[model samples]
Target chain A: MSNKTITIDDIEVPFEEGQTIMDAALAAEIYIPHLCHKPGLSPHGSCKLCTVDVDGRAVSACTLPAAEGQRIDNNTPALNEVRKTITQMLFIEGNHLCPSCEKSGDCTLQAMAYHLGMLDGHFPQFYPQRELDASHPTLVLDRDRCILCELCVRASREYDGKDVFAISGRNTNRQLIVNSATGRLADSDIETDDMAAHICPVGAILIKDHGYEIPIGRRTFDLHSVAESDLGEIKLSNVRHHDE
Target chain B: MSKLRVGTTSLAGCFGCHMSFLDMDERIVGLLEHIEFTRSPINDIKHCEPCDIGLIEGGLCNADNVHVLQEFRENCKILIAVGACAINGGVPAMRNHFTLKQCLEEAFIDGIGVDNPHIPNDVEIPLLLSKVHPIHEVVKVDYYLPGCPPPADAFVKILTDLLEGREPSLPNEMLHYD
Candidate 1:
């Protein structure tokens, strides 16, 4: 853990040689909002979740590993405002029907909203037309609920050893296709044996017979809060598979 | 339970669930007490015929997979989609980016394809589904056990519950819906 020490919000902290700025902040029990990134993952630097100001420069913390004696300030009012706006944009970007979303209590995006005190999604919802593929006996992909976090996509490519999935298209019109052309995962060449599908963090991908498997009384979401999940030992990088 | 005939298949997958099943370890000998496996690695590679429970892993890809899934559907009393691939088209479904014709051209006929192509006797590759589909798309799934190969405990839970004729209990931490 020997490296440069720096002050964030007037608190003195020591940085490990290769640890990222965000990791250090988190280690000190500080919270920063982010998406498109998870622990145990090759830092995407995609979602600006761990963004913080390093000597007045806004930067992503996950990709930028730690160095010596650098001053960082994450508690700026202006930065907090920007983070809220980013959260709003994400909410409206997808058809995140929070009231009905399966991840309503457990979703990271949802948790961010609460941490930031966002009462509404704040932007016009973009209702993308999507189909429901119940063709697969057990799993169903409801494209309408997808946020395009690309977690499942990465899980497939990296750990599954089955390169059965990928993201297609560029920006707004981007969609997830299964085997070849359609949204019907029934046709996807992906084998049922792979573990990628379970990595999806949203309802875009769901397993049958599992929903409502445990009643509301025994659920993980109501039992924990986003802030609580980020602190102490339970705070984890990848919430999908392996436990840390 | 009359010695139940069980069959397990892997289409295109990492073979984790199979390993997980094997991870049932010594308890597997206990499972062997109840099940008479027909087609599996522990046995010999045989296409699934009529069986009590047909546990399928991976999604349908290539020509052989479709036929085998169909065979299992027709013969098996209960068809279970096991693991991520079997449930949600998992990861391999990413290829829907290109047209099949384009994909074939790139993989086979085009220069990106194998240089000295070993032209095969079998021209019938299971028609690539227009896109990836979960197993239930082709046939009815009596039960679906999803996990990334599902956790080993998940397998034991689902299996033992079935054997006990009680509703299976998933791990409290395993995310079920989202």
Candidate 2:
């Protein structure tokens, strides 16, 4: 392990060479709220949720390399307020009806909103009309809840070895599209067990028959905050046991 | 101590939120000691009188809803948007995805079971807005309590805090969208 260290909110965190600031923070069991970033997948800084102040400059922590003596601010009221607004934008941009949504308790977007203490969608809701694809035998893709995180896009290409999904268009017109000739998931190369099928951070992609199986209040985020639940899992499986 | 006047009304919402407010149950008897019902379903009051606090459930879907919400805003010193509908338009706002004409046609003309297939056009009926909107869009809301129907404890917390002259804030556990 490289001896290089950086200060996150004045706490010394060591990093290995080539490790991004996010990698270092996660390894140190520090939770930096993120949506588009998943470890082991090439970082796509689309969600902008993992933005941290690096040496007084705002940068995506997942892509920014950890340099020695770098002063980073991860958890601050000002930064959290910005993150809250970003989460709100994500909410308003989509028709995320959490009460009716199957992914309400398990959704990272909702968990992030809870973590940020977001009371309401602070801005005017765009309420853009989007489509829902139920053509797949075991999976459903509801674009109404998509936040353009690209996790499914990356997971399909890198992990599942099937580039079944890709984003099309640009700006407000941008949308998730299937790679199949019919422009449907059923016609695509994706399978029920594919990483891309299960990689959506929000309710955008969901399993067909397995929704609302776990009762409310017993689901993932209900048991613990996203920070505690995700970081604890990471600590248990990867960081502490592997380090030991 | 003079009892604080409280008003409540439900617009384009399922009365679930109002039911939850009543779910305060016996504690409501204790609440009555501090607050008096001014214009609420509990008292079967129609027009709102001047009140210390107004708890509004549901979103603005029609002209009547807008008028009632504006009256609440005008009469109440503090207006709290309660539950999912009042905060972010909730299930009622689902209609926002389609045009008002489409919704009316679907409900009246184009529906599978329709004995009388015509849009209801009556002088008594309030005109539907083009889009359903959260209460905050039509009027300034002092506080927002979010949930499908925020738990009874949440209502207690907000009311107790306001009654004590404190800023209304739900605990992390009490703060949920669904």
Candidate 3:
């Protein structure tokens, strides 16, 4: 580890140098609210939900590279206000449908709402009409409930190289698309093992084979908030566990 | 002119795959050394012409989206489905449970519709694509990559191998998504 330390809000933090801000924060036991942010996945600031005050400007901790002497304050009042705005934007942008959402207690947005104390949307709702494609043997789409976080799309495009998923339209009207023009999930080239389905934070998309099968408590949504869960114990164990 | 011109296009995907290409960092300049990027986000070309490789990101969900896919097929000698969305219908395939009418009505004309107009029964408006599909279904794809977009290293390995006209030796059985 390089002898370099970065400061976040008067707190001097040390990292291995080149470690992402989110990674460093998580290592130092600081919580950064995120949905698409995963250890195995590349950090893209698409969600805009992880924005924290760094030198008085809102920057995503996941993407913003770490530098020396950078002051970070993720728990400030100003940070909460920013988070609230982002949560409201996500809430009104799509039909979140929290009451019926499978990812209720364990969702990134729900936890962010709790963290920022956001109750309702301040912006007017833009209920874009999307479809529910469940023809695939594995995944299902509840487009109405999508938050346009682009996690799935990124997982497919950047991580998978299939780019089998995409965001159609512009701005608030954007929506998820599968394959090329075929539009049928069965017809698309997506495989059962693709990480795209696992990346969706909301019910807008789900792995059909796994739904209603985990009995209630075993699903990730039922477990805990991403912030509380941290780096993800399951992934760690699966990686270099003694059993392996 | 180089025999292997290339065009990279994004359909309904997040731009992450393209970013991943950039994630290759300075290695890209070496890639740029050989092939040509005809139509890309970096380039402003709208329609794609014939090329050596068509690197497609995102899946298809709309009528116009299909047209673009067809264009890439017409233009590229070797078309590749570059992400999960193009591989197994990805996450967007989840929405096929509902009909096109329902999706459109819910998005625009339904009681919940917002700024979009309810173009009810207009011939001018393009009809919805039948279903969300993986790239191979709509058109024959020469190769399929099955990551969300696939790790950047995976991409680098595949592209370098492809450029050499040899089978890419990146993922083995364990790496296959299954």
Question: Order of candidates by DockQ, top first?
Answer: 2, 1, 3
lDDT of 2 by residue, A128-191 (tens): 8887799998889999889988989998898889898989998998899999999998999898
- Cα TM-score of candidate 2: 0.95
Superposed Cα deviation of residue B48, candidate 1 (Å):
71
Q: What DockQ does model 3 achieve?
A: 0.01
B33 in model 3: Cα distance from truth in Å?
83
The positional error of residue B140 in candidate 1, measured at the CA in angstroms, is: 50
Q: Please say which candidate is ahead in lDDT: 2 or 3.
A: 2
- What is each candidate's DockQ, to 2 decimals? 0.01, 0.74, 0.01
- Per-residue lDDT over B14-99 for candidate 3, one digit per residue giving the tens place of the 0 to 100 score: 76678777787888788887777888887878878778889888778778768888999998988877765665454565456567
Give the per-residue lDDT of model 2 (tens digit) for B1-178. Answer: 9999999999988989999998989999999899998999988999899999999999888999999999999999999999888888889888888999899999999999898799999999999989888888878889989888999999999999999989888899998888
Q: What's the candidate order when arranged by decreasing lDDT?
A: 2, 3, 1
lDDT of every model, 2 decimals? 0.66, 0.88, 0.68
**lDDT tens digits by residue: candidate 1, A109-172:** 7666556644333344454555567888777787766777776677677766655556678888
How does chain A of candidate 3 score by TM-score against the true chain A? 0.84
- Where's the lowest-lDDT run of ten residues in candidate 2 chain A? A235-244
Q: Which candidate achieves the best DockQ against the true structure?
A: 2
